[model samples]
Target: MEGPRASGGRAMTGRSGKGHRDENFPVASKLLRPEHRAPIMAFYRFARVADDIADAADLSPSEKLHKLGELRRGLDGDGAPEAVALARTMAERGIDPIHAHELLDAFTQDVTVRRYADWDSLIGYCRLSAMPVGRFVLDVHGEDRATWPLSDALCAALQVINHLQDCAKDYRALDRIYIPADMLAASGAEAEDLALTAATPALRDAIVATAARTRTLLEVSAPFAGGIRDRRLAAEVAIIQRLAESLTARLLTRDPLSERVHHRTVEAVLLAGGAALGQLFARRRR
Candidate 1:
């Protein structure tokens, strides 16, 4: 549990992207009930470590995969500190281990798969990588399985938004690419265009086009806020949905290759607060 935190000894100064705790998007944020935080943080820690392993430019591909394999072993009760913490937390919270395992499946893909053939293929990756976070949270709150499809849409949208924001960084730092190949072909663009200091018209068009696709997921996820059984979780989900859509809107306008697309702290606070107010009104009407 503390092992990962103890061994690194490196302080996260925010831009390093060196740890999961340094992540820009929310995970286990304050919206959840107090009791749920521990398991969520543990899960985030495990995910962060695995991401670190995959993104380690100094490590060879084989070396990175081997570290990821250790994380996989944590599911079976033996792995690194983060994985062990995840296993114990799952057992304690009665949370299923499958979500974490599925994440590993995606991380393993990161070690090998670089190009996506089509939209469906890319979504197949999201089913493993992005969808699990939502599923696990629902499970922690004891929500029904019927909500998963809507949750999947929201989660996948959030995931895609992250990819779009980091397209340039992913290409430069991790040598990873998540944009589907077919979409780029359709736009007469290639992934290399993202590596430039500024996005070419073709690359910007491709991202704008992709943002349209991500928006469809948000549109389909409209029912997610109401589907949750817990009132508190409903509010939190609403806030996240709002944030995702807002960021997506920015994606459609911003030059991600050169300009920042993420919300500042004050902007995010306002967005989340607005979502909370909307949820409150919706609940009162119901």
Candidate 2:
């Protein structure tokens, strides 16, 4: 719901994606040190705005694709200010531009692909849409390459969680469905069920099953918490991991059609505090 107001062009203002806290988990939040803000924000601005374009209800598929291409061009040094800033940051940090490019690939896919055929297909989508984010963060911190597999898993899990949370909205508003077709069939459901005002029992069962699958991904990626070198980042990942786990559990048993499933403010504060205290004790051990 925190998407951009425009359908296309350079009409997007910085105010559009400047400080949205709706990422479900912390992204560019205060948990990170101040110095990390600008660069992270630069990347976030480009990605966030691009996401807005892809999700814009008023834009045609061709129109959305064009805006996404413009973003790519900006990264190549000839587009919007947000993309230019992102390009400059990537160059100065010696981070490869390919990571940002990966997101472009996904956005383009969003323009064309409206439904996922199966889990492998969905994960393939995640490789482009999600994995780059974790890779970008790792590159920013200069973390070791060995940690990438776990990071990839965690990021992919987060992506799936987001997809599931917005499943109803995505279907109704954008005519997109990230839920796998196979899973829906298994539950005696179809993609059309998502457009209903209320989720039927079979539809809810399928969604819960998918949530359970996402939870397994989080478990596999849990070790990534210890693998991070930056204490703040580690704490951040810990909080995210915890939040993702909590959200998935809620999704697994709840009816996605009838209610919301998310962490409240006090819950977020507690999770962050737990992560920070965890880092404190971790440092004492070191």
Candidate 3:
């Protein structure tokens, strides 16, 4: 999230200047064809708008819900430019609006839900918040619907990686903690540990436990890229998988509250390069 932006000349809940680049993974990156990229960016902006509303520190829960409703109406036909744009793209591409509506459901939950009770509950949230984004992209590419289960695994892993990386900031800034209560309790840690300057031993244990679980999700998604029939989209998924793997490994060892968990630009480029070449080679052999 960043500074607010004006929506069509009027103030729309703090617009958080957060762009695709600020995201943990690629968004409409160059890996996909230009036609594919356009609709993806539209969907991303619509999502960003809803996310900004849900995350606005200044807004009350009621206000957030109201604004989210307006965004939803926009998705239906007319609302905000962002929502209208996404709706138009969906219509043009013959894509269903269910995925976008599912995302709105997650954002609506974000307005009211602050803590996750267990791993099952956390994954349930990801089913709404993360899984649809991948499905939407796959739809835009006209990929087989059969590929969704693997895509769901990869997207859920990415979502958890983000939760782990932003744990402390989310706790302090929003009072929202995604680290499941059961995991925290099992490690003798409490939510307050996130407020400290660094992670306590218990907090570290809980985080590592979450990271380990995320790794399992990644393993289940290992066949995802190979399963995709679209070469470009397959390559993009491969790059994202590598990035998720690197970040998950960092979370396992480094304290995100005290240490940098994200990759530096040079390192990310190298990892993406390697993954792209490997994906290309694997496709050639196939």
Candidate 4:
């Protein structure tokens, strides 16, 4: 029997329907042009399914690794439905399959590893887990090398911010800690500090410092928002930056140990509106 076509049969629909809704879809859907939305959604769905496989707590690390290997084969045009769907999208968009592969490799690492020893180690993880997402987004937007470094900075910073925000939850549930173990040790903080009912001065100081570092990275990437020629793309970048700024501010004000900080719906709407207005002004200036 002939193998299923890479873009046809059950293979074309892929693994997207089997798991959690693609987390990136909501953000990507909002950011992409209407015509581009379907392909972007498909890409996010493919990535999300791979992520779910790696993140499934019920699966042993060996099982996750095996699944990830299958995912990699699928990316290579083997007839796995999700991989086929993803490969078809990549074929149409000129997206590098290497990026998708890198993401799976990262997910596999996460399943096997639980803690980062230092900032360098953490950054190594980001290079695999976070930087590829930025590259994927840039590929979707048809951005070139001139913008990639900045996009990587932004994506890595966002990943770091997410780690800081989810520190407690990830520690409690996954035994994963994105914060450098060395830093925590050096600060005289223990893993137990994250579980405290209130933020101790040491823990609070560490988190605040990390948030500041993320803010610096975000600032470095800010100019790229203005560099994009597409209005909606510019708005998307602006909105993300504004949200980061807002989150950073919230982090600064809240007791991280006692209160989880998150942007409220109304705050998000206003920030997005403000970002759109800022983008309009930027375009007018040019």
Best by lDDT: 3
**Tens digits of per-residue lDDT for model 4, 1-286:** 0000011012221232442221211255355598565666666666666666665656667876787787778887884577788888889888887777777778788778988898778878878877777677667778776887887777777777777877776676567778788777767778888777787787777777677777888888888788876677777777877777777777777775578676667777788788879888979987
Best candidate (score: TM-score): 3
Prediction 2 global C-alpha lDDT: 0.78
lDDT of 1 by residue, 209-258 (tens): 88989999999997898988888888888888898889899999999888
Q: What TM-score fits each model?
A: 0.91, 0.91, 0.95, 0.87
Please tell me which model should have the higher TM-score, number 2 or number 4: 2
**For model 2, how does the per-residue alpha-carbon lDDT over 1-286 read when each residue is reduced to its tens digit?**
0111122222342223434465677886676777675677788778887877776666778888888888999998999778999999999999999988988898889889989988889999889888888888778888898999988888888888877877887787677777788989999997889978778888987888788889889889988878788877887888878888888988887666677776789987887788768766876787
Q: Extract clashing residue pairs from model 3.
A: none
Q: Please give the TM-score that candidate 2 achieves against the real structure.
A: 0.91
The local distance difference test score of each candidate is 0.80, 0.78, 0.87, 0.70
Write candidate 3's Cα lDDT for 1-286 as tens digits: 1111112111345477778887768888888999999998998899988888888777788998999999899998978788988999999999999999999999899878989999999999999899999999999999999989989988988888888888987887778888999999999998999999899999999999999999999999989999988898888899999998999999999999999998999999999999989999999997
Q: Residue 225 CA error for candidate 3 (Å)?
A: 0.6
Instruction: Please state the error at residue 141 of candidate 3 in Å.
Output: 0.4
Q: In lDDT terms, how accurate is model 3?
A: 0.87
For every model shown, the clashing-pair count is 0, 0, 0, 4
